[model samples]
Target: MKALFVAGTGTDLGKTHVACALLAAARSRGLTVEAFKPVVSGFDPHAPDDSDPARLARALGRPEAWAEVSPRRYRAPLAPNLAARLEGDTLRMDDLVADCRDWLSTRDVELALIEGAGGVMSPMTDEATNLDLMAALGLPVLLVAGSYLGTASHLLTALEVVRARGLTIAAIVVSENLDAPDLDQTLALLRAFEQQAPILSAPRAATWDADALVDTLLA
Candidate 1:
């Protein structure tokens, strides 16, 4: 299966937005797609509408996938490791990686997307981080960043980290942030790293074209 791991510079930077767009685009082209976010914090099973997994499921036209998409969920609205500890549970790195592998093994699809919680260095367990998980997965990364202030620094820092770890980057997407200054400048800054990977820009969610975005991602 062709897989892409969606990671962001920080939390709420539209990782899900990009992942859902890719799923929608793939489905539009009649390509079977599946998405997973192995560990999710701030998830409420009762109020599924407010959860990222649910949003991804809705985008994929599979409401039932919400549960399967995020098997390790905590309601504390904190980092996965901290939240798991608060809930009297433990997040073992090996177990988390095994769960992802098990899920992938069961799927037969053209594209499988794995969305990470928080930023690349966010801790999944006390001993391992999302970056470690990404390396373990051994898939190209679709790095997501916001066009907000200081984004240039954050984006470059993330790029350095990804490179230091020797992970392949499929692309870098700058998700529009309404509170941000001129995005043209942000795009220009990202373009400087084109040699690292393709850099793409995305409009707000309301006006985003999944097909077009997918075309860029695949390119």
Candidate 2:
């Protein structure tokens, strides 16, 4: 499987946006794609029953059982470990890895895009983090970042950690999240990163053209 983990410098950094873009792009190119959000911490209190795994299933036109794609979910809107602690639940890294391997075994897809919860350093369990999970999966990383101030510092720090772990960096996608009015600065930053990293940029809104981004990745 040509798999990659889509992670970010921090939470809400458009990791899902990038993952979905990659999936759509690969599928368009005749590659079967599957997505898994290993753990989602936050849930809508109003719906109470909502799971991000369900949304992912819908994106891929999969069945409701696809909610099983995620190994864990917590009611609190916090890091997985903390959330689990709040609910008096225990988390084990071994179980998390086991669930991921099981999902990989059963899924019939050419490429799997595993989306991490929160930042790369965020704790998935008391003794493990999302970075550890990525290392366990042993796939290259496609880092998703935003174009705000300190983006370079944030991305560089993340790159340092990823490199220290000896993980392959497939590419970096710098999104200009639509919530911001700054565009020129973001473009300049993107250009700067391309000098060293395989940097791609899109507008915060409709910032991606699936074909182009996928082509860049494959290139």
Using TM-score, give the best candidate's number.
1
Tens digits of per-residue lDDT for model 1 on 1-219? 688899999989899988888788789899899999998999886898879999899888998789888888899999999999999999988898898888889989988999999999988899999999988888889999999999988989998998788888888889999979888998987787656687788778654777766776665
The backbone clash count of each candidate, in order, is: 0, 0
- Over 4 Å off, model 2: 45-51, 63-66, 179-181, 190-196
- Residue-level error in angstroms, candidate 1, position 218: 3.3
TM-score of each: 0.95, 0.87
Question: After superposition on all CA atoms, how large is the RMSD of candidate 1?
Answer: 1.3
**Top-scoring candidate (lDDT):** 1
Alpha-carbon RMSD, each predicted model: 1.3, 2.5
Return the lDDT, model 2, position 123. Answer: 90
Residue-level lDDT of model 2, residues 1-219, one tens digit each, is 777788898888878777766776687778888888767787653663355666566556564645566657778989888987887888788877787778777878778878888888989998888899988987889888887777778887888898789898888888776556476677676567556557777555554666777886666
